[model samples]
Target: MAKQKIRKGDLVQVIAGKDKGLQGKVIQSLPRDGKVIVEGVNRVKKHTKVGQTARGSQTGGIITTEAPIQVSNVMLVVEHEGKKVVTRVGFRREEQERTLPDGSKKTVTRSVRFAKKTGEAI
Candidate 1:
């Protein structure tokens, strides 16, 4: 399996296509397909066939729901210079767990930086 930089729940914005400038949380990521489903983005209507035995005899209508957009068309939203900016993945040095003065260990987290601009971690 190929490793994917973007994961579910990551806030991303559409950088191209009809949904450009729209930002939403990632519902899922399909690395194999190079596509991602975002909340409230690239919404398309889905039609469902109604059956006679349906509850309340309600007729199904067009349902608007988000569809997956190509990963290349979206950019991850990150913070930069006190402002929100699109960012590409850049890894920092891995840090080990730190022990506090009170004898407690904390999970270490590395900083995330912009791929093109800053070299420093988050």
Candidate 2:
């Protein structure tokens, strides 16, 4: 499996589906399923039977929440030139020097995500 680009708390815009053009923050990421739950998008109503909790408190009722949507349906939103815009994600590997416990500096390579539209780190 490839790495997941979209992450929790990332602002994204729905590019396809009934919620097209809607923007929201990603609440969760499901990399294995290639899905993400966005706040205020793909709202779903769930019905539940009345039940008692371990604390003896009421626990079930009609609930509304965001449902998972395919990661492809959304695009990451970034601010560009004082305007909000959607951009594709790109990964880049960079080398940096790190100091080891032995006081020796070592070069390490790390992957980073960046905005393809503006060529800027994200």
Best by TM-score: 2
- Model 2, range 16-120, lDDT digits (tens) per residue? 999999999999999999999999999999999999989999887899988999999999999999999899999999898999999999999999899999988
- Give Cα-based local distance difference scores for all models: 0.80, 0.95
TM-score of 2: 0.90
TM-score of 1: 0.71
Q: Write the per-residue lDDT of candidate 1 for residues 1-122, one digit (tens) a residue.
A: 65566779888888899989999999998899989999999999999786565456766678888888988888888767797777876656566689999999998876554445544344
Tell me how far the alpha carbon of residue 60 in candidate 1 is from the true structure, in angstroms, after superposition.
2.0
The segments of candidate 1 whose C-alpha lies over 4 angstroms from its true place after superposition are: 52-59, 98-122
Question: For residue 71, what is the lDDT in candidate 2?
Answer: 98
* Residue 54 shift from truth in candidate 1, angstroms: 9.2
Question: Over 4 Å off in model 2, which ranges?
Answer: none
Point to the candidate with the largest lDDT: 2
Instruction: Estimate the Cα RMSD of every predicted model relative to the unseen true structure.
Output: 4.0, 1.5
